[model samples]
Target: MSDPGLPPLSRQHDRRLRQMYRSAGWPCQDTVEIELLAAGLLERRLEPSGREYLRVTDLGIARLAQALDRNRAALDAHEALVLRVAEEAQRAGRIAYRGLGLLAKPGERWLQLRPDVYSIRNTSVEDYLEPVVHEIKVRRADLLSDLKKPDKRAGYLALAGECYYVLQQGIAEPEEIPPECGVMIASASRIEVARLAPKRPMKPGFATWMVLAKAAPCRQPLEPEPRL
Candidate 1:
């Protein structure tokens, strides 16, 4: 529970924090964008140092003053939503996360990456486990925008680990005691445990072969040319 005197994380606070980060001139510009959107501030462009950008808006400074007076407990409570949902999903035999997604690659590099709520379920079939993919989307009524994106989800999935559950939340009223929320689930998939196991050291001959492979590219093409 938040302190009685503490204020909630309003969109106003979000804008203020963003202004703070921007004025500081951090190299990673998206950090400010992510923080602002996560806090539900006015949606802005992903660009850095826009032509109309101001060091700090009058409204932003006022909000920051109010935030400084409030207890920090509210901020901690709000961020815990991610771990809380993951724990609940784990109890139900599902892997869940708040804002992790997947990325897909074209050729050797990823073309797009998307981030959202992701979950996976393990399915058993004749002693084998397969992973089922799930995606969660959040849409706020006031904003009329769906926060879910495929690239984000793809990026999360591309990572080495697997997650089996997801919960999406959209806050309609930033000032309300409990912000409005929504959730969705992805269909479950079986997980392959054997593949995740660490591999044993190879014999000398195999080790030597592996060293050779690493030292030089394969003589033949890895893939056939695509048909026109």
Candidate 2:
């Protein structure tokens, strides 16, 4: 299959991903398992909402046919973490939190934006759902004193917007930083549009889906005529 130019599906092992997906299904929370299962990528028997815990089906070999190489590798690394964060957040019962490696669009480009860690909480659901976005810079205590320049802030925000990320978390913690550029969580929940930081200039790459929206037909192609 041709490269979708998209990131890998499962960065960590499959077991970890399943655990996170299952945890997201708790009461009054949103989870991606339903959508993924609907895509036939996951198989499971979910208890009725507010009932028993659901069972997850092991990934079938057939799935490998469609998964990208990066996605497979991601499952080993960041993808697993995405699930871990979701589960941990839900478990902690925190009202606000950060999500990494989620799909977002800035201008035309569809790049992966991973936040170091983001936290959000509000007095009520209404406030939590407001549309807003913000760019954050994490700094070490030593560097924090000197690196408050406007250019740095702008640079970080620009990078965030380019990746369609409204939130940024810079963990200068000696141990928290990863060796690579970064890792983004595959799926996450958005609190509210009003909560995301104000709109900024978008970068060019893959056009934002909204701009590209059109009345295109969704149909399967017909097979070519068989040789006589």
Candidate 3:
């Protein structure tokens, strides 16, 4: 058979290759196995015990390194988009919080909801604290997957005075999001507000209060709220 042209591997493919590099007994998915073999990234070798095992070749390692580099670059770019949104919010005098985790209960450590970026306008008892949540969507597949989680949106609505979807240009249509949600676009040059989010301040329950409490001063310095 002729050689199959090697393309940039997905994160999963790169992970599998790394697993193979570490251990010959690494489990292989059918598609990954076929692609790795065809792409000349992996091979089956007989061990001293006569057991056949999969291993990543030098070429595979090189490709995995390249894949890792690409993954890092993509992550950096995505993070830049997130940072820009936060900066905009802050410039408007909103206190920005990135990766704020909302839990169902104060005792639980698990996240019930995690908005990519969220902000609270002012910090004190001055006026009603308006919470705005931002969900960043860089890929359409990821956006579609998130839209399926109605509970997440509902959770945000419970706490948010406004919720906006910060997305890549053309990645998602405004209709794809719920009517209650607003949309914004983050591109190479600037972040634009396509649809302004309506203010619908809700009575924040204990959990929502916990989210805001954690957002104070800075996202990193604040600790999780103690169980009430």
Candidate 4:
């Protein structure tokens, strides 16, 4: 839990803090800087030449460390879920890929979408490939933010026959997600499908086929040796 007495700081504040820590500490002279100064996270320094610069205080460094740890933990959780989804797809006899950057023209403008897991059925028939996209989210804030972007959903729909949102358990309910997408909740033990995604009759474009051809799919885990 955070201190209720202190003024609330957002990711933007943490980002600025990291930027100042990495750079020469020249002030941006923006509202973010003002808030950081007021919060004692930043201090102004006067050099002998009368030039002014900003410096991160001890408190700021501590805050930055905390932010980094939180980000790392979130990333770990996200990646774990991504691996689970990919493995599940593989078990279903589909070829799965992770972190593939594909171009999608959901509307008039082309957008790049990197789904957490992209999979296609293993079949010789092109129409039966059934490409699917699985987007993983471990944080509620991230899930909510993604829900607001209809364009991103459109891009996923454009690239795959079905799109699904794989969420960390307790992050959200299936009803909160858009009707067009399916929802799956992942716990420590297993993944449960909360909703089934609607399957549309679609085929991957030439660009998508080219990208998949050039990229490698997720490898299956090694099986244990039989007992002697």
Per-residue C-alpha lDDT of model 1 across residues 144-217, encoded as one tens digit per residue: 33334334334434432332223223333223211112223222232112112112221122332343234421
User: Pick by lDDT: which candidate is best?
Assistant: 4
Q: What lDDT does model 3 reach?
A: 0.75
Off by over 4 Å in 4: 1-4, 28-31, 224-228
lDDT per residue for candidate 2 within 13-32, as digits (tens), equals 34434454557433222344
Candidate 4 vs. truth: CA RMSD?
2.1
Candidate closest to the true structure, highest TM-score: 4
Q: Give the better candidate number (1 or 3) by lDDT.
A: 3
Model 3, 30-49: lDDT tens digits are 88777877778887788897
For each candidate in turn, the TM-score is: 0.32, 0.22, 0.77, 0.92
Quote the lDDT for 110 in model 1: 63
In candidate 4, clashing pairs total 0
- The TM-score obtained by model 2 is 0.22
lDDT of 4 by residue, 179-202 (tens): 999999999999989999999988
Give candidate 3 misplaced runs (Cα > 4 Å). Answer: 1-12, 26-29, 104-111, 123-127, 214-228
Q: 1 or 4: which has the higher TM-score?
A: 4
Candidate 3: worst-modelled 10 consecutive residues by lDDT: 102-111
